[model samples]
Every structure is written in structure tokens, then in C-alpha cells.
Target: MSTSTIFHRVAFIIGGGSNVGMHVAQKLKTEGYRVAFGSRNPDIATLEQKELFPVSVDASNPESIKSAFDLVRTNLGEPSIVVHNVGIHFQPPVRNDPFSVSSDTFAKSCNIQLALFVAVQETLASFRSDKSTTPKVFIGTGNGLPFLKNMPPFFLALASQKATMYTMMDYASRAYAPEGFRFHYATLVGPDGGLPNLDPSAEVGFYNSGPAHAKAFWNLISADVAKSWDYRFTYAGEPLMT
Candidate 1:
């Protein structure tokens, strides 16, 4: 695969119906990529008007994800870029009590990691089969929870799952680097280089800006392959190896 070859610029974004996912999709569409937004319930009318494709997907279900990928391939060609933006987080029933978390809740939260693994496998298979020179990139959206030593007790399940997800993606980045594929776990932080406020309605700072994340993702995709294997990056697109 060489850069000179012509191929469709297709992107598949999991959990792309709202928030950061929609922002990334819009950015890619503006960059001339055919974008597919995948969620449990897709807003087809809005997506069609934006010239974006919509596919129904349940991130916790591997079969649903596989079907979504198939639909993208059939509608927009093999996606050279795949973004996994789905995650699970919930406050414990008994705040500040880690043990108050139920087994079923923890199991359900961890299942997103399994979904990410399946998405990665599907992306790699698609990349291996495509001969285009476009960058083959898979990005997993993350946050600062994984790095905190004293994580909030209510966030125990989320912290554990994110740490595991980070490890899995880091391994994938190294394992597939020889083949020119890029795997990145983007950790979004506040503008002042601190943890972002997790409240959806919080207007803490610029780090919460969807466009900023979109730009960071675009930068990662446009980076030189030689410098793109760092496995993790900050919201500013700076590599974070440690």
C-alpha cells in the first residue's frame, strides 16, 4: 500500500450518535472522508442530511458490531479508520463505598472492553485485506481515570475497566506496528493538564470541547507512521509513553 494509490476515505465510528463521537464524525466528513455513525439507535435523517451514513450497533454485542462493520464495508468501502468511543461509567449505589457495587454492574461495565477487542479484530482484518495506502488506524477514547492512584470509590468499576482497556490497546499497538497499523488510546484531560470533570453538563474548560478532541484525532491519523506507534496520547495530541 502506497500513498499514491487512490482509495475511498472511509471512517467507522462506534457510539457516534452524540457528544465526542458526533464531533469526530463531523470532522472526518469535513476532511472528505465518508463517515459512518454507529449506535444502538441511529438518527438516519440527520446523518443523511449531513451526507454521513448511519448504522445501528450495540457496542456490547459483538455480532451487532460485526454487522455494523459489514454494513460500512458495503456502503462506504472498507474503513481505513475506526474509532471506538463507547465506554461505561456509573456512580455506585452507595457513594464512596467500593464494595457497594454489585457483581452484575461490574460485569456489564467490563463487557465494553470485550467489545473493544472485537472491534479491533474486525478493524485489523479489514486493514489486512485492503491494499490502499491510507493509514490504518484504530483509536480508543479514554480519560484520566486509569492514571489516578486514588480513584473515587464510585468509579472503581470504570477505573478498572479503563486500565484494562489501556493495556489491551497498548499491546495491540506494539503487536501490529510491524505491519504499519496504528493503535492509539487517547486520554482526554483538562486544558490545564489535569483530569477533566466527568459531569456531562460541566463547562469546566476547553478540554471538554468536542472539536478539540476531533482535532487531536485528525492529527493522530495524519501523523507519520514512524512516529504514530506511541500507543497513547493526550488530548493535545502529545504522545504519553510513561
Candidate 2:
């Protein structure tokens, strides 16, 4: 399916309250997509937007995710593009001690991984039902943790979850490629392959901003079919075929 034909199609974004999610949603809206923002507490401004639909969703709950997709389908038709931008990141109380992290916190990370699995299943079902020739794209956001060999001890849980997510996306991309479904896992990192810097004063070259992420996502979605099968890539759309 060509980008021109899918301009007016529907796009559903999970975790749309995040900075990167909001930028991607705006990009899709500007490109003529009927955008649906799924978050636990959507911003009032987003809910008021004309072509943007804000649906409440809990990223850790499978039922909540399904319900949110249902609402999107009811209001904006089936989503041809689905983005799983939900993630959990926090430091252990003892900073460098991975064992200091509570079991509940680790469980929360597991729940998020399960949620992504559910979201991917929901997207696949939606695409199978829709008869339109529009692109069936699913983008999963990640960081450098999954690919790192010496990850920080305090980020153990997050690293584990990200590794699982990367594996899942890899499988999905290969399994669904023949069906015309594109599954991409985008790693948002610096040009030198460093993690994102949240500090506003950080050097521009060392940080990957929300707008950069948005642009990378758009590039993935608009990529030609021959290039679409490349699942893992950097925030700048550079392929990491490994």
C-alpha cells in the first residue's frame, strides 16, 4: 500500500501521553490520519482536537487495552497503524543495587511486557479484519538497554523487559511479513549509540528529542515494501539488522 492512499486512514497510539507519543500523534494528524490517543489520563487539549480521538487506557491491563481499541474502532474506524510506546523506567532505591528493587516493581515491568503482547495481538486481529489495502504497521519503541552487554545493575528489570520486547518484535516482523504487516522496533538513542538524555541542558547531539522520534516513526511507516521488512532500527531510521 502506498503512503498517498493511507493518508486518511486511522492510527491508534498507546501511551500517547508521553512526549514522544504526543509528537508522533501530531505528525500523523498533520499527515491526514485520524489519530487516536490511548492513555490513562489524556490531556484535555488532545481530547478537544478535531481529528484526534483520546481514549482512556491502562497500559498494564489487557482488558483496558482491548476496550480502548474498541472505542477507537467505533469512533475512527479500524486503525491501520498502531504504536506501542508504553514503557516503565525507574531507579532502585539503592541506586546501583539491582536487588534493592521491590518485587512489586519488577512485576509492574512484566505486566507492561504482557500488555505489549496483548496490544500486538489486537493489532493483528484488526488488520486481518480490515479489507482495505492500507498499510498494516505496528511500531514498538525501545532504548539501548536491550542491545547492551553491560547494562546498569539498577536497570535490571527494565533491561529484561526490553529484551523480551525486542525478541517479540523480531518474531512478529518475520512471521507477519508475508501478510503485508510491518512490525518495527525503533531504538531511540543518540548518534553514538548512547541512551537518551532527559536533561534539558544536555548537548543536542547526545540527545534524541521527541520530534526526532516522531520523524523516525514516520520514516518507518512510509518506507517502501522492500525496506519495510527491516524490523529493528535507530531513531534516525538506520537499520540494525542484527
Candidate 3:
């Protein structure tokens, strides 16, 4: 029997209704992984994609997360993978500085990222209940440079959370390695949403971040490994740091 067989494996994705989350879910469905996505509105997943189950989840509320995970567990089996793609982008574009962002908003941002840790714990607990032997994967989509490096002004919440999550993933990657769990943090260059100082035309050849990263993740999980390999990947989905 092959050590890797992804058919019908479950993936619980947070915020998988639209944007990059939608793209990732589409890719995973194509690869034959049963996907249950959590978003505010379950209605976003239409009749077209019958296999994708959408559950209502409020990213900021811990109770909502618990409920969502419980729903996923009851509906589909324990998930073989968990994708933390939830984030609250600052509205109105905060190009200025700290004065622009209120403490309440930052608190919400912190909660958004902190939810991943909670989800990861609950996910593992679910898997452990049945003593599942299948290797599990946790994937977190990140932004900007990790706070350890440089913090972009516009990405205040993102940088702060990304840095902490990076450290969390690093620790989990090591602690869970021997038990056959894999963790990955990927910082992807998203679609040309027409950001400042960037020409949309110049991105003609750039890899589509969502689908590309999804494929990269699937490939990683399919490959046989003694321990968790490559804790991070680049925007181009390259595992090597170059």
C-alpha cells in the first residue's frame, strides 16, 4: 500500500469562501481532498461545488471556533489538514502610522491570528480521539516580512501576528515532527489588487499565489518524509531559502 493517499482526506479551511481562501479550496477539491470551509456565511459556497461544505464561523470569537470545529467533526471525520487563512485587513488602508489604528482594531487583529493556535490544538485533539495515524498538516498563510525582520507600516497587525505565528509554527514543526505532523508558514504575493507603486501589467508572469501555494502544499503532503520538512515556503512556492 502506498504511504500517501489523499483521496477523501478532510481539510478544514478557515475563510475559504472567497479571495485566496476560495482559490485554495478549489485547488484542494481538485486534488480529491474533502474540504469543509469556515466563513461568516455558509451560503457563499454554491450548488456548483457540492463537495465543499461551508460552516459559519466568527474568527474573532473562540466559542464560534469551537462550534465550527465541532460541526466539522460531526459532518466529516477529523480533518487531516487545517488551513489558517483568516485575517482582518485594515479598512480604509492605513498608510499613515500607529495613530490611525485604534487599540480595539489591533485587539481584533491579535484575536484573528491567535485563533490559529486554538484551531490547531482543537484539530489535533479531534484527530487524537480516534488515534488517527494519518500524517496531519497545518498551513498558515502569512503576509509581509516576519516581525523578526522588518515590519511594514501598513501591515501592523499582520506583521505582529505573522511574527508570533512564525514562532508558533516553528515550535510546532519541531515538537510534532517525530509524531508525523507537518506545519508550514507560507508568505504569498497575492493578485495585483492594484497596490500603490506597482504596475499590474508587470505581474503577467507571476505565479498565481493561491492555486500555486495550494498545489505546493498538496505536493508536500504527498511526498514521503521521515520528519516534517520545509517549515516555510516562498511566494513562488520554492521550499529553499535563496
Q: 1 or 3: which has the higher TM-score?
A: 1
Q: How well is each residue in 91-170 modelled by candidate 2, as lDDT tens digits?
A: 89999999788998888888888888899999998899788887889988777787766877988888877787788888
User: Which residue pairs come into collision in candidate 3?
Assistant: none
Candidate 3 lDDT over residue span 14-110, tens digit each: 8764556777777777777778888887774381356687788987777788899887777776788888876666642457574488888888878
Give one digit per residue, the lDDT tens place, for model 1 in 10-92.
89999874668889999999888989899889888988898888899999888888999988887778899999887777678
Query: What is the total number of backbone clashes in candidate 2?
Result: 0
Residue range with the least summed lDDT across 10 consecutive positions in model 3: 189-198
lDDT (CA) for every model shown?
A: 0.78, 0.78, 0.66
Per-model root-mean-square deviation over C-alphas = 4.2, 4.4, 5.5
